[model samples]
Target: MNDSLTFCKAIEALAANIWPAEITAYLDNWQLRATRGVTKRANSVLAIGEYPQLANWLPHIEQFYADNSLPAIFHISDASPPGLDALLDSHGYALGTPSLVMIANSQDAAAAAAQKLVKRDVAALTAEWVTEADEEWLDAFLRLESYHEELKESYKGICERISDAKGFVKIRKGKHIIAVGTAVVQGEWAGFLNVVVSEAERGQGLGSYLMQALTAWSREHGAARQYLQVVASNTAAVSLYEKLGYQTKYGYHYRIKYDLRPLATS
Candidate 1:
């Protein structure tokens, strides 16, 4: 792998740290993570290096998730071994949620311009900083799913575990919160996670504004490079990030095997 790819992988590693899994186990080059199925990225196995022991690893991974009552999943990225995807396909693991990892130079002109617009309205935006997400942030971001206490607590635990410089941003307009995002800075790299705009507030460019705000916050705190993950099917978000000068660095997806064990016999 070249220097750029290595750097991107390093950022991904940092991301895994920022959003920690409740249970993490390593087998050679593979990272097996589980977080009660709250999020695929947190739950899936990440093949970080050549896994010559993949055959042995699969059974163990299946049992690990089975023990926890979660699906067995693997996050396959460019960093994974060659033919690993085909290998998983042959094993009956179905692919899910292809996503892109995008990166941008924080000092890029376009990003700088967006930052200016967000800075101009800094007072109106009403930024709330929290180490762990409060009910308000969870309500705005998770929306309908916020009613589930376990999921909300899982999110809170993940956010609170970020040891690096991090910020959970809640941007409000008047009494109503309009946007939410999280930024974690490790070394010169800053990763943005869970950036969402209110469903009723789409097309108003709040997404771009949120990105700029997060990027600005990141850069001010010593991050020169910014990275974010987006589902490949989210064209609107991809376009907005592209307009802000982010380019696709790599793509990854989860290969999932659902547990088919029958419920107890009465």
Candidate 2:
């Protein structure tokens, strides 16, 4: 393989190991899992390397589920063997919504320094700021959702977590929230998510201001990098992030349909 592809593959492997822990830390609390033989929606076995024994692995996978009394879910990607899809189909494992695997680097100084916009005099969001369980937050999110529906539920979850946890920031005006965002510390890396601005407040630079605020906070907390995901199709967001000094370290593809539920038998 070429050096660039090899380096990317190495990073993907590292991320595969590191990210699963991050997801499990949170998902294990509310999400369900079953170990029964690779049927789906149970124990999710992720493969980041070669897959040699296609046929023999099934019984072992089934045994893993049957032994644990849980359903078995195998997460595979295009990097895997071509036979994986057919094997899963023959074994009755259903597929789930695909996830985008995006990455970013914070070490680029020019990009970070290029973000020179001045912030407005809006109030900072705090634990007490979102105490009312208000609809204003939900409303702003719904407006954003109109443009990207996949974010609707995810934004709700982030808002709820920020309301209950630390690392969330906001700017409000007289009981109305103009902008909101949340950040999380992961070693030397800080991740940003759930940034939203009111529909009426868009052109006023609230979105950019919140971004600068989040970046400043992440830097202050000793983070050497900041990362986030924007839907591949959102040109506006891609432009904004590019202007702010974020580079596309990689891209992940995804597809979704709202009407149909996943089936293990398929």
Candidate 3:
């Protein structure tokens, strides 16, 4: 009923709704074969907040699969409150990698971009843009995310959604696609998701170019603000984003835990 609880509930709901249907159902009630929008098997972990006890949810989680069969995995951050981790660990879950959550308000961003990088005319991107994605683009996208886990279909789904949806943009150099980004519209705020630049293309200011292009796209789509997340240890990226007008609004971290121990494969 209070403002804080209301906001927390809203955040949980947004996180849940964005996942695939099977994931939502599995987390919501531990059902199987129940596919939801974009969520697929390799991408099945769903985060729930303000929910029932973890002990009660363990059966459903375990029933789905063992360690190797983990259809989906999620890093359960202490975002909920005390004792959540204890309950999860007691059930044989292991902590996973963590990432920092970041946000920016358009009201503060609408002003001239700070430390201007030579503006590339966002429209220039359209000239070199090919299909929303191609085999080469997909390969590069996967390489950037090789550090973490992700479902093949999950990326495909995201690409499908962005391709058909308005307000998505990409920029390329010759046959090589250099930059990509998407802005998910939520009320007055646009969640900037999956901004990636090829490793070979780094330091050329493509990052800032994509940021400005995405920010401009967000504004055109009626978004009043923009936000995105990066790993806490990624100092270089955080510094660049700060220079681009983003301030730390909040942070979310996750650790993956399992319900069963890993079996020897030998």
Top-scoring candidate (TM-score): 1
Instruction: Quote the lDDT for 8 in model 1.
Output: 56
Error of 3 at 97 (Å): 2.0
> After superposing candidate 2, which stretches have Cα over 4 Å from the reference?
1-116, 119-166, 255-266
lDDT scores in order: 0.79, 0.49, 0.54
Q: TM-score of every model?
A: 0.89, 0.54, 0.72
lDDT of 2 at 245: 68
lDDT by residue for model 1 (54-109), tens: 55666777777888888888888877778989988987889899999999998892
Clashes of each: 0, 10, 11
- Report the CA-based lDDT of candidate 2 relative to the real structure: 0.49
Which candidate should be chosen as best, given lDDT against the real structure?
Answer: 1
Per-residue lDDT over 93-161 for candidate 3, one digit per residue giving the tens place of the 0 to 100 score: 565545555667775554435345645443334313334555555565566655223455555555554
Model 1 stretches with alpha carbons more than 4 Å out: 52-55, 109-124, 144-150, 260-266
Report the error of model 3 at residue 254, Å: 2.7
lDDT of 1 at 177: 81
